[model samples]
Target chain A: MNSPLFFLSYFVLSALVLVTAMAAVSFRNLVHCGLSLAFAFLALGAFYILLGAEFLGFVQILVYVGAVAVLIMFVILLAKPGVEERRWGWRDLVGRFAGVGVSLAVFLALLISVFRSPSLAVKAPEAPVFSIAVLGEKLVTEYVLPLQATGLLLTVAVLAAVIFASQEVTKK
Target chain B: MLEDKSIYPDLREGRRVVRPGGKREAKPLNFPARRPWLTLGLAGAAGVFGALVGVAVLLFLMEWLKPGFLGEGCFLYAALADLDRAPAILLNGFLAYIASFVPVPPILLGILSALIVIGVLIGVFLSLFALTSVVERKVLARIQNRYGPNRVGPCGLLQPVADGVKMLVKEDIVPAGADRVVHFFAPVVMLVPALLVLAILPYGPGLVPMELSVGILFFFAMGATTEVAVFMAGWGSTNKYSLLGAMRAIAQMISYELPLIVSAVAVVMLAGSLSPEKIVETQAGYWAGIVPAWFVFTPWGFAGFLLFFIAAQAESNRSPFDLPEGESELVAGHLTEYSGFKYATFFIAEYVGLFAISGLAVTLFLGGWYAPSPLLAFIPGYIWFFVKLYSLVLLAIWIRGTVPRVRIDQLMEFAWKFLIPMSFVVVVAAAVWHYSGGGFLGWVVCTPLLLVPYLLFGSAFAKKFAPSGRVYRYSQG
Candidate 1:
């Protein structure tokens, strides 16, 4: 698992993720940005697969790359026909600096939590042979409440979206 | 002028058409008359002979190689286990033989085997794509009472070849306003996912290309990329029709994908695994040592199969569900701006996508490679797999021929109002069937559970949406 090929692929995938994520944010064309975001999501899924969470990787791709990215593209296409170009003003520069500072702060907080975690202090254990069935069992048995909550939240969101869309249609 | 007119039938009829000179007409320099059947027969015979010879050579090579030299994964030994495993074994044996002498690393050997599997899958499915393209036209032609592409070699069997040649030679046109990179990559993106999905399907007992724990999820994940690719094609083309077509396709796909995945979830629940191989294994054996215990044999399974089939049809953008590429409105949809081999690639991707979906249906409901009866178990599993697959493809073609393209709104309504609810019913029915000990009691309970909703939905939809009567406005009734 820790073979040179593994390291090579990991590095390559990470590079792809970073490149695509950067492109997603920087691209002027909204569609291009959406596509880049999809690629980023896909690369992230690949990272999940690399970490041996095959089910999670697939779900990540299916939900994010497949559904979320597509929804983003749909919204972009439906909203406007032209590229979204914003002038770089003093306010924009200040906002960028503020955004950088916030992101850096968040990153540092995450880094500190990771370094301080008790699990990380211990020697790494043997990689467990994880199966989807076990994960599903845990979801239903131990994490059933969370699962139900998520489902309920999603259902409500869907209903709200339907209502909103239907109202607009009626208005039109 | 009169003498020339007498030599030509049209001229003699006073049409005054110019005729080629007798010297030019008399020149029969080369080529025999088109003997399509004879050519086809010869090709078939040659192919069989070549395959036999190739098998014989492989057998001879296996015989000559030392048995233990290639180690445990050697095909020479595996081939002896079951004759059905012979093809895969022989191929692996050949690879193993190379590895034995070459001192290849284990990872490289694994990669090599994976590559071979990928290659074989691509080759087989691409050929299937070609065959389906011609067969689809022929089936549609039969439905329409028209001869389809009979002028091509051997009753249009070689039409795909001609089409390929034509596509290859044709100009690769790109719209001046199109985004060059995105436009160029769209077909490739479309093709990659179509091919990738094929990897997870269990073609036979030990014949899956890439067996992952989450095979079904992987398949759906790969399939999701098609939407992105379609969007790329539409957006990159900078054509409104293309964009609209892409949007329609994406919407239709997303709507139908819910039912598709949910219906499959029923099977996964019953089978107790996301892996297609596991699902197929759970579906093995006969009910009374006669009927194959395919999922479609059960009531919920049957309903799930239907829902999956319909959703699969919509997913592949086939006729009836093909509102995105509705010819009356959108000129080729997202494909309008594509030309030549790029267009050909898109066409191949569509058929391959169809094959993948059909293949998945076979895996889930029809029993992946299991024979219909124990009596038919003599046939190889992959053969049975392909048989089921091609049958589903034929059914798809039949439906495409019979049904008209559905309206986009109607398509959405069907997916959302009917298919989704029915699929949920199927999942519940599947759970009931499982919990109730899965036999006569299961059937009695599940059938009505599925049927009642279906009937209610059908009636409600029909009452609300079905046109009452067509009144003649300007024409006499």
Candidate 2:
């Protein structure tokens, strides 16, 4: 059984996640949206710690809140000022409605799947050590192919970034 | 004096005004003879007295009043491990007394203990951070053949206190157009990462605040938030200068942090652990019972240390790489809009960051808390750690004094075109050395592997940046 402190922290972090997520979507300023999104990510990271994934939690904070969010803010700051709000047309209104409809449908589907899962009734087993050493060993041995695939993906992403940055579009 | 417009009225207008004023007055003809030595002596005596009182309290608690309140063998066990258990033990005893009257959950006790430990650490290190600023200023002033802050209590020993008071009492300004919430949060965000990184540093044996299995990764992970904080400050300020400064500062930090992390990878690879204490422990033995097995001595490690040091300078925004706050150029960068205690908070963050990174360097490349030689083992490891750490800090100050700030373009070039490539070579060299067991043949193979690239890159860099000899024309000597 978990301690009440654990539940209290979980509730606090979940509250942070919900609030920041809402703020991220609803904030008017693009920079504020990005920052709120970063806060959401940070809260999620804290949630990971509550789930007994300390490394994953810190990595989330390091990568998403630190790098990705900073990069988003960089682009936001670099974009031309006074590009805030735009007038909405009929197409835009329709698009907004469609987006909301799609998201609601997806949420309902996810809810059904979670409730329907047989595994949901089972209690969690005691967590493994899951230390960095164990993680590294597993990655190299059992999950080596996935690790290589991730590396490949990262390389391809870097190549794409280089191509986009250089901007020498071949007129083929 | 508090007129905001008067301070920088023309800055926004892109104009400079020269006020005609009387020439500097000669030294006062009727100046009284001042006895600075008396004040200095008194300050020294007071410091010694304070230290003695602290020691006496520690002794009284540990020996004379070994509180029966403390569990049996608690003191001996904590002392044997060399952990800083004073705060925790004291808190436990206090809490136990409370728990005798009222029930306390184990979780609550644990949480309260952690809180007390963190509180004590923050109090102690914040004082150290303040002292570092005063130390840096004094050292820089001495290097420039000037007395610094002598008016503030005996050789400026009390200067940080005065500075803190000034920062607190000064007006806190916010530009009308600034994002008030984000601006308020920026300094707080900035301070958090600096403090967080301090948690991972192993001050001495068993003295780590939090010994995460991935301590070094934790340090860098916390470090990543600094750029985001910088960006927030810049964007929130609504000033072009602040935005530009923030961008430059963030870019510099991102750039330099690459080599900094990569260089430490060599140490991590060799130590086979990410924990700072483990890394230090691996470097404990002696080569010939004289030379301590510090990573700095290995060829690859030597290169990595140099790379880490240089990149750290940029990351910390110390001079030569201090283009972010280039006073003559960017008007204090992201800090342009900050004033008073807000600015002082940023100042504290920078110094704290400097100390943290340098302390990391010590843990990685230097012998950490280990004495340099076995013969000098009488001095404690924590003392040795601080000695090496402050020496690096002084070296940073010296470099700041000696070198001119590099241009932004040059700074970027140095990180990407030079340091990053060199770091890769150093990593390769470490691998080679490791595989070869770092014997004589390994040196033969790895030295050129490391140096050839260095020579080529150094020549290319020198050719581009080094000034050609100047010839004077129309000189009538």
Candidate 3:
């Protein structure tokens, strides 16, 4: 009785996610495809809540649902209109089937890998006193140097992103 | 306050200031002093009252006939056995509705009605503020030496109201190419999170409805919803700029959030609790006088506070960091395809976000609605909080009208390079400062010591700036 809500929510959320992921590849329209992907992200957030990964759930909602989905939408919107059409064919149908097949295969493999391991990992670790305060202490005391280095790493990445975006296109 | 130039201030004038277009089926956005929709309003009210009476009569009849339909095994059924009894559920519901309207006596009725009135007043305030786009534009206009929306009403006092009606009347167009369901839900998705954040905010002591122990956590939860909603709006629009806007939003939000949290960490450490009330109490007086114990007073706290402010601006997608809605770049970004009420929803969500973030900043750093000092303690908690928030909001608006939006790379660099590193330093400094029993003055003194290294090493960052310029020049199509 206690876990029934979670269980029901999990099944529903997982179905939504699976359908969306499948739709991402199956949809004839590219723009519709992006929307299905956004749906998958949203369902994943729901799944996070069901798993009791509250912080991760919010992070999922924030990063994937909010930022990433919004950005993707912007790119799709700004892209050239009337670029693609919904044309169905044996080739398209075959490719979609193949995509589904490959996805299923990979998913099964991942599931096997997870269960074959010593223990099934929960979504997030239960820190002893894990509020924002505890996270802060570890960030400074335990992981201070790596944390600083992450900043430097981010700086280099941003520099690199600029370089890639700016570099001239050359013939392959 | 600026004297309201609208016809509303002219109650004494008695000049029959009829709002043009007369009454309609729906309520106009304007809070009309004169009953514009008197007939419709009365009819609606009459219908509602009739329904309440009808419901109660039906409920009484049903209970008299069979008894166990609505309230199973309850005293209502037992009491109903005697023919005449106390109020039924329907009667109670009707009473609640009636009591909501009238001035109840000086008892529970009065108290309940007062609460309902206050809640409605707050709701109205929030809704009005949400639609205060005209004021923003006017202020921005004044800054730019132009009068905005003056043609709409008396200096455009009723501009937002007019705009609301326009939005209502406009065609709710759905692009044939777009995902209709996602498009429909997108604005709703965007609006819900912004509204929920308002719930956690301690408007003042004994003011907020839900005074949860983990108010900050609830805030964080709501904040995350904005990202998901933005994504939906972008993706549902089925456009390129929308996609780009979503990406920019994600990158910006995730990157800036690190510093935002880091800065907040210092506050949490100093306050030693997640509760907003506790944070305020801790900062009551700076060791019996001399200094303000607010986070802004500390060395690391200052650095953290600034970082937090910048990150908040980015988090809320405010200007300077508002790359998501770079109007010139993405043609209003994720909202390009949106129009009518849908567009209005997104617009409201953005401003509500601004208020929420500013409110959070005031709570965490500026001491959660507490007055500036003991000298000013006579000032109500909510007043100081609002003053701080409005000033912050003004700062945000000022920057919006003034600064050009940052390029994607520069925005990213600002977060990753400067904010990220600086936030960590602040965290460490706070921990060390705490260990040393560094009084409020220590935090005040150490802030400059923390920044001296930045002043010296800042010349190095100037060299890196040149490389980005060179890259852009080399890569231009």
Interface RMSD of each: 0.5, 1.2, 3.8
TM-scores of the models, in the order given: 0.90, 0.87, 0.64
Tell me the DockQ of each model, to 2 decimals: 0.85, 0.69, 0.30
> What tens-digit string does per-residue lDDT give for candidate 2 at B253-296?
88888999899988998899999999999998888787788989
- Candidate scoring better on lDDT of 1 and 3: 1
Q: Which numbered prediction scores highest in DockQ against the true structure?
A: 1
Residues B212-313 of candidate 1 have per-residue lDDT tens digits of 888999999999989999999999999999999999899989999999999999999999998999999999999999878999999999999999999999
Docking class of 2: medium
Ten residues in sequence with the least summed lDDT for candidate 2 chain B:
B1-10
DockQ of 1: 0.85
How high is the DockQ of candidate 3? 0.30
* Higher-TM-score candidate of 1 and 2: 1
Query: CA lDDT of each candidate?
Result: 0.86, 0.81, 0.70
**Can you tell me which runs of candidate 3 are displaced by over 4 Å?**
A1-53, A59-172, B1-125, B128-131, B150-155, B206-218, B238-246, B274-278, B456-477
What does candidate 1 score on TM?
0.90
Q: How much of the true contact map at the interface does candidate 1 reproduce, as a fraction?
A: 0.82
- What is the lDDT for B266 in model 2? 85
Q: In angstroms, how far off is B469's CA in candidate 3?
A: 14
